[model samples]
Target: MKNKGSRRRPNKAAAPRKGEAASDGAGGDRLSKLPDDILLNILERVDTLDALRTCILSKRMLKLPTMLSRFDIDVGNLARHHDAASYGYTLNHVIQYNNAVAGVAEKILSARNLEIPIRKLRLRFYVGRDGCLSISKAFACTMATQRVDNAEFVLLTEKSCLKCTHDNLLYYAQQFNNCLGDYPAAFAGLTHLWLRNMRFGELDIPNVLSTCKRLVSLRLSNCDAGVRSVLHIEHAQLVELCIEEGKFEAVQLNGLPKLQHVNFVGWCCPDPLTFRSVPQLRKLRLEQIGISSTKNLQLSQFLANVPWISDLHLDFRSEKIWVLPESPKLLAPVLGKLQIVNLDNLPEGCDMAWTMFILEAAPSLRELCITVWDDWCKIVTDKEFRRKNGYCEKANVEWQPSDFDLKHKNLVKLTIHGFQPDVIFVRYVRRILEVAVNMGDISLHDRKVCERCMDLDPEIKVCPSRYPRTTEEKDMLKVEITKELGMASHAVIHFRS
Candidate 1:
């Protein structure tokens, strides 16, 4: 943004004229030396209008922008440009902002005459005033003229912005809906899609998937449908799916054949994560997830159907901790292929036992990383936060792992975080090293403290708090685990802050 005292220069970019010469015309020029395809690919990375602006440079580059496989129509941040941000939202400022939106839509419509298919398209526009519905219909008309493989359409309403009121945003969406007809007819070519903010208002997710059978990957993040609609997903060509920060009542995932990756983050409500016959699912991540159903939302059930999941990461925040119990059906596949596992937010005094239970099940595990939050440590030092979150900071109980001698043969590397020097914790580590004959390397790290945690509650103490784990405490645990486990003299062990 430029101040009035330092006015920005006017646009020097002109429309493409015939027989224009390059600014510097040697064959050794950096841009001209590249092949025609490479030059076109570089232009595709920019916005369509910005790409056209380059046509003023040379005549040979004029025809290359029309071959762009990707198109982006962004208007959210355009209001912050020099012309629009010089003053407050007065009458003149609002006119300039609306003109910027029309300019972006016009550039996208120009691609219709090129005839080449758009492999990927992303359009982000604001919906606030009278022209929003017309803009939406013009966008659909442009879609009807061209074929697209991957497309994302985001209509940012007033609910998502602070400058406009909710009534104005809802009116714009309602107006757009009254005129939007047969939009599903254009989904025949869309395979990959991502929608934000606009949910069932303009598009029903279930109906869209049912109509578009060729969809491979779908992501719905921060959408109203997650809270308002019931999503019924069943596709044969779908491979990857992600639903982040949604509150859906019933999200049914059924009969996805080629599905390999699934990421569901921040399930605010207690909804069941249904899994119906996904055999090829491999990689899975559930972060900041909590379910209301204690029985149906079990990890064992999700793993029983999918046998080939190799890499797994789970970060849970819930009323109860999930125990890794022995299951013949799940253990058979996990023992054969499961290689890497990362577990975070593991509660102290109760999670060590679960670690052994997991090791017994996955005999082929190559790497294991666990993040433990010392419950007693936090209470004794940082009591206010624990109390604020309804956690019992003062409740006293003794806990230890169940007896097991199962050989975790393939485990060669291990990293344990939030290491404490208590007697019970040291014994748990000693027993694992004794049974795990192929132990190669182990690293124990102190707890990690972030700025947010320290800023939120000043009463809580940071690492090396009132009761810090001294060097003597760390040394005692290392020495005992190594000596009792009968580990080789050359095996490596490290302790770090």
Candidate 2:
């Protein structure tokens, strides 16, 4: 054996050394050979802190920030170590983190060819007693010159301006002044802006708007200050706008020739006299808001005047109707061209009347939902009044099934709620279900027919003598019993009657 192979137990160390060399030939060597541009692209995809860590690898990676087209600085990450109760004292960690970001940003700013003009910038900071102003001032200064094509500013805090002093306003003004003072003329080409949980007064709104002449979209959420004041948006290039839960008077579109979508919340109501100015407006949503309750103020009337809007959503939750006679007739012709209508939380009395009116008016109305109370007396009384005047009698009218055609042939879904599942209701459900079974092409249907009739009469349960059933009848001896009741269902599948 020694003569053939010279293997006196071939050295194990040599084999292990060969395997180590093979492993080194793959990943480690390949990664090291990748071009700097490719490595910078990889680092750019990670968060800022992770991006910074790439610098630790080698001096060649230090210039990675110049390749970043986007920058998102989250200040909340800095303040995580401070307990709320101990927040009155200065947090050293917050200061350190701020300093670190400032240094990185400075590097980004100073890079000549490496500082690619940012296409987007997002800053999230909590406005608070300790460190918000300085951070905002710093961020604003950077933004004022960054030539960002899009920017988002989010300031969150539980502190209310209503509780703060004049000094607080002065401090805010100083920060705002810093941000707005030399706002680079470069931002005039920016296209989008989003602000959340940040308050701005009348002066601030105009000042910010002036910076973005080419802005196509703007969104504000949960910000308050001069909320009741109307806005005059004068951008010719704007197309979409959304404002929610902020106090603002009326919204006036100044000169947005390309504008199409508008969404609003809080207390702004469109002025009926000035709505048609935006000729291209097509879609609008109004939610969780108040409209004038004066007898002369009518939503339908106001909406009718605007011919450009094709889609509308109105939510009047817990709101009292200001206009009297709650006629669907007034709303129908106006909404004839509408593709969708959502009426939520209308009062029981108003709901019934509105339903009838809508069914009559909008022959083109596509969907309807109505919720009524569980009171039997109210239903009976209302039905009696409607029937005496030649409205469909409660018993004669066929309940609309999910497939049933409505005044509008296109209606697809109808949901009703808050009805007492009593004897009368069960019979109503039975009638509706019977009608539904006869309809063709059933799809996505839910018919919750009552399983039992409950006696909702309060006085009937108090005395045994007042019980309607006799002992013999209860035992099948047959005693006579009687009660009268009343009516309605969805807007779908056409019925011959």
Candidate 3:
């Protein structure tokens, strides 16, 4: 690395001369003294184009870094070439871009032979409809022969999807199918693999899962494919697996003994799980799945086996509700460990007792969200349902919440939707606050008169003037008042003291 520019004058403390002028030719002196290793490191950090330009700077920096163990060849950089269409350059520039990339790739691949024991190799290519199939075949050929420790394949472009009549998109999808034959050997050492928006054809997912023994994490999202074999795992090395929005059937979980987290979304399977397949499973999720029905779902038995589950989100709208047992004792043991529960459109008559079960089982619960049948859960007035027996008033709550709070002291937050809090609801809130001294947050939706400003605030004297402090104005603004309270009730949020 030779110094190209003039250096500054020497400091007064060190390199001062006796008779030579302060502006002596010592300007270039300090830069020449820098070691070769530091300059080489600086040059290696530049982009590949700029790194190649360094060859013009000095003969010594012309050769690429020998110690470089990792290299990424990106075709996106070559795609930036500006060419005028008036000069008869429609696909000509694309051809030039492809040729330039191929030339660079050849040089890099040849260099890899000399840089033996290359740890990581990354190739990212973007191809339009005009990209030659020969080029894709050559790229796949290189990957099969190269050593790739970690790989990411992203095929995302309108050209790749091929909106026009050409077979470009189909060709792109078939490339992955062709690459699968070499996947075992090419990606044997791979620790992480991510494939996104890929149109895959004839890739054996089960074979890939089995062959990639060193794989610890795998993610495939928005892959376009037809019904492939249900993903079966014969390996236990996988720690995390995520499959979302693709074509696949029942995923066999038998082989993943060490698997901790598994996410399967939009996976249309008649049965999502088989017995004892995932014993070590910690988190299981099924969202927006197309299950024909929820009849005879052995839900409790399944929950009993998955004791480590701390969060469960299941959207079972495809199945009928009210089929399961409705007592706390039946569900509390399994649900006791649950920290978050989200249920939508629960069958009628499922709300009142289901809430009690939650309060019992998940005492450590921080948040509870439930959709209830408002028309059915009537508010039994205070005059009714008095404890007739020797049992204390706390023993019986006709939808009273104080009883719920006494046991679930840690219950800090509640979210209720579609439940109109009549007199019963108000008492429930009062009791819930009693137990939750820290008084967590609450959210209510689709309520009619939960806001105090609508009706209760007039009685409380908070907003007396504009909000119809008078009785007649309050009657005229009854609807607004009702809307406000309903919103507040839906949230069940604790109000200011």
lDDT of each: 0.60, 0.49, 0.50
Model 1 earns a TM-score of 0.67
Off by over 4 Å in 2: 1-68, 81-102, 106-119, 126-149, 156-174, 184-190, 194-204, 220-230, 245-249, 268-276, 289-297, 317-337, 342-406, 413-497
Q: Backbone clashes in each candidate structure, one number apiece?
A: 0, 10, 15
Tell me the lDDT of model 2 at 30. 53
Predicted structure 3, TM vs. truth: 0.50
Candidate 1 pairs with clashing backbones: none
Better of 1 and 2 by lDDT: 1
> Which stretches in model 1 have alpha-carbon errors above 4 Å?
1-64, 80-119, 126-147, 160-182, 197-203, 222-230, 268-271, 289-297, 317-337, 347-351, 372-403, 415-432, 439-457, 464-481, 484-497
Cα RMSD (Å) per model? 10.0, 13.0, 15.3
Write candidate 2's Cα lDDT for 153-272 as tens digits.
555443344554445544454444454454434345446665555556666767767776767888776554554666667666778888776655566666767878887765544441
Q: Candidate order by lDDT, highest to lowest?
A: 1, 3, 2
Clashes of 2: 10
- Model 1: per-residue lDDT, tens digit, 149-241? 676555554344334344443454354344233345435445666654443542455556776567788876654452445667788889999
lDDT of 2: 0.49
For candidate 3, give the lDDT of residue 73.
49
Please report the candidate that would top lDDT against the real structure.
1
Q: What's the distance in Å from true for residue 479, model 2? A: 31
